[model samples]
Target: MEAAVKRRVEDYSLMDHATQSDPFEFYAALHEQCPVYRMPETGFYMVTRYDDLRQVLKDTDTFSNDVSAKDGKGLQGDLGVLYEEIIAERGWAHVQTLQRTDPPEHSRYRKLLDRVFTARRVREMLPYVDQVANDLIESWIDDGRCEFNSQFAMPMPGIIIAEQLGLGRKDVARFKRWADALIALSIRKWSEPEIRQIAETELEMQHYLFDVFEDRRKNPTGDLISALVHAHGDDEEPLSMHELQNLMHQLISGGFETTQSAIAHGLWLLLRHPETMQRLRGDMSLIKPFCEEAMRIESPVQGLARKTTRDVELNGTLIPAGSLVLTRYGAANRDPEKFECPHLFDIDRKNAGAQIAFGAGAHFCVGASLARQEMVSSFTALLTRLDDIRLEHDLPQPVHNPSLYFMPMKELPITFKKR
Candidate 1:
């Protein structure tokens, strides 16, 4: 008998596309041997333990979100330089907003965002969300088979966000391309030509958004873009054009990408676990918990970068000042120390809500509630309208696209009977 090869922390490469596609094994190894691991290829530290990540997230002062300071260290080599040359020459330069700013500076943007993304707004939007879900389902229910990601998952949220941003549902295709371009650099390994193309697309989006912002400012429509344009406290100053542009970039990316991933993965999970699907069909009330567990298992925004403000020791690992730290939310969600049988897909798991899939503390995702509602809406519609959902036999294996930043499935081809 051959001896089983033991895995070491050093054996894993965070930059590899294959590893990014299925990283649970790496997460397990990091959690066991080194919760605070430094990548040999890039020297970036990754924090994997649940408690340690919470601590890092909470201590915003010690762990900053200001990634611009370390510009060249990002995965996109020379892309930042290209961005400056391309964008600054034609349009407004990108500035740090909600996801990239820290402390009092972050507070300014957060207050405005909180006002725009209010709970009442999300509540009011629920009906429309359900309508979109059903409408998309109606498009493919007759076929008894559909490409879940493109046909349903991608467009459902895409149309909603486009309409909310005052662009109307007709522009969803362009909106998706713009959003994809905005996030392309951080998600995967790209060639030099591809990087330039991404930059060009970004410039195109900047110009398009500039025109929209001007229109919203001149005529204050009550859409999300209008709210952002007019939002400010009596004491605070109005946001500059640079600020608004960056905010739009953040909103456009955050509004749909993660939610799309969540919706697709939710159905994929149920298809994989027929018993869970039957249980959810019986009790529909468990849909919320099912969404929570789905996000916990396959977090959409897998890991985000945070720059250390000063030298700090975390779980006995000493990290230097101004170093990049990747808080692996995907890894933390599955830490054996945090959850019993971490790999099991238990919809009834009591503490499933404790997962930091939306992150934690000051920088928690602002669209979290909306994302949850969308997931609930999508799954509820699927269960109500379809039966015996199962993966198509000819479908490709390893469905998920390889991405370091986002957990996007390349495609999900499923068949089901209309109920």
Candidate 2:
């Protein structure tokens, strides 16, 4: 309603450029001048400043997770994206990895999925994860010339998570399709037909998963799906079919994309700085920190869109109720005020351990532990076996998807020497 807010909206709503070029630059501009900007497209406000973002995320009472916000639905700040749209087409079980739910609902879904990522679960899986990574590495070890991204980084986590979920070898092909569909960034802006295509893919995937869930219900295999079938609230309400569907969708999206992107980006980062790689290979102890450091820099998830419950003030910026607010995690991660030499990747940074790649607040990613485990196993297997792992091609530029989430590399071609 204010001229300043209207003017600010015009700049931020140029989704044309934001979806194409480097959005971090745009976010930096927002952080510098208007850290909180209202968007006309979705009628939401976004905040990117370090202090503002931290405050907003932590203020769960004011900023609810169910950005499918109703009363203030048309307000100036809205946040939820990639929810039912992602689930209906892909099936609820697609990713069930967790995002965008308010406390009671999010807590219920998380309880079922969260157990898969426990310390004990992850530690136990490390050997198997390592074996998965090593087996892939060993196959390439003799080949001597391999495109690490496609050959190694992209596929290992898919196989490992699918197996750990007890989906087994039979489900490998469908699992990869789910992973590929989630990560294969559209080179062009997704048009109506493209949206239809995504819808269709979601439907087909949903049907496949529905079948799987049905089979699990009848047979009761005691796997995650079986556990889900049996999981309940204290009130003893069985998980609704819709909730189960959403749960499955989150699992597929999270399990597939995040790990693959982290591994790809981590390897790309290590490859870009051979000196860092050399130093890391020499001192493998540093690899864990290096992985976290790389994630801090090249964050797997880009930004989160949140809708404000009502008119609110953040960092002196007024966000009218019911607007889309993008919490630019990628930009926040690189904020120099938050991290020293934020642009430059440094594994040894003291605060590198504090990045929000898993996000902050009540809705933080449940799969953070799993992703960390996958990356640890993924890198350890590769770094330990490979003699000199380095890039084979020019550093690939980031392929930004039009969607508000995901910072996945289109392809990362690398050539490495084996021991």
Candidate 3:
């Protein structure tokens, strides 16, 4: 094996774009030296070890997901306050629903979400997912070359989630804009003006969704939005318009972006390991394992913030009460203690499905099933339809956009022969 890059715990910074772009080395360093390292810039603690993260994730009481209570000192910092203010001015105030809430309250929302995003629903949508993947591949297969992210990755999940939300396939571009605006606030650094501009775009989305919510309430259309609007059938209290808005915020952003990252990274992994690609091309049975390993090696949702409810020590390091702790899923997924040759992309690895890329415990991603199906559907179509898949060498080295939370590829230029 090549000598590991010499790095100190101090050398890493989540605020740095370059660090965010390629953090695996830093994650490896964290695994070896500082399993729970405090960020000097933001004063937040990063828990990198797999067991440590599982502890944090499972013990929601100790590490609260109700980050709104922290007064906007979580991942986005004071920018979260600015965002809330902007939305409150023009639209419903942000509420803690699925991703933001804790315990009993969260269970209420989760139950409703589970009803709509059920296994039956995802299985039923498989044909549509397959069709979307095929349609996207067909669009560029004849051209022999395409920018994978813009042309295929972004749209496959986007159109599915859009039509499911009753936004219709035609409004996928608008849905993308809305999702991007919401995601930008969390993942990127921005100036005051830029923050305001992004917040305004979020408000635009809120207003549009609000109109949809009102329509769904009056006349149910059987779409996901309609189901969410009328999910409670008189026995339980229905989700308020405010709660619905926040839930929609989570769904839209969660639905498309992470899956896009996963699909793009899956292809990138195949391109990097031609032998693995060849093995996969020979046996489509390996596609699911390929997806699992892709998610493990290149986690899309790298980390999410949790506020400590009380002072606690993790791996000999003490974290104070009210301190923001980032559960580094990307780091934990590569922990050498958990997986041998942790950095190696091994599709046959038995524990690949155990990766917490979709998170673990109660706050585990609600759309995980859909995301998995989307990835499997995507790669199954891509490998079946295209031959000689290779990257366009002239493009930039780091294809991923800089993001603190997500590992989204900005573009993926590649050439392939239609098989």
- What is the clash count for each candidate, in the order shown? 0, 49, 0
The reply for model 3, stretches above 4 Å from the true place, is 1-5
In model 2, the Cα lDDT at residue 251 comes to 72
**Model 3 TM-score on a 0 to 1 scale:** 0.97
Model 1: pairs clashing at backbone N, Cα or C within 3 Å:
none
Flag the better candidate by lDDT, 1 or 2. 1
List pairs with backbone clashes in candidate 3: none
Taken over the whole model, the C-alpha lDDT of each candidate is: 0.87, 0.67, 0.88
Higher lDDT: candidate 1 or 3? 3
Output the worst ten-in-a-row residue range by lDDT, candidate 3: 68-77
Model 3 misses residue 91 by how many Å?
A: 0.6
Q: For model 1, what is the C-alpha lDDT against the true structure?
A: 0.87
Ranked by lDDT, top first: 3, 1, 2
Candidate that beats the other on TM-score, 1 or 2, i.e. the better one: 1
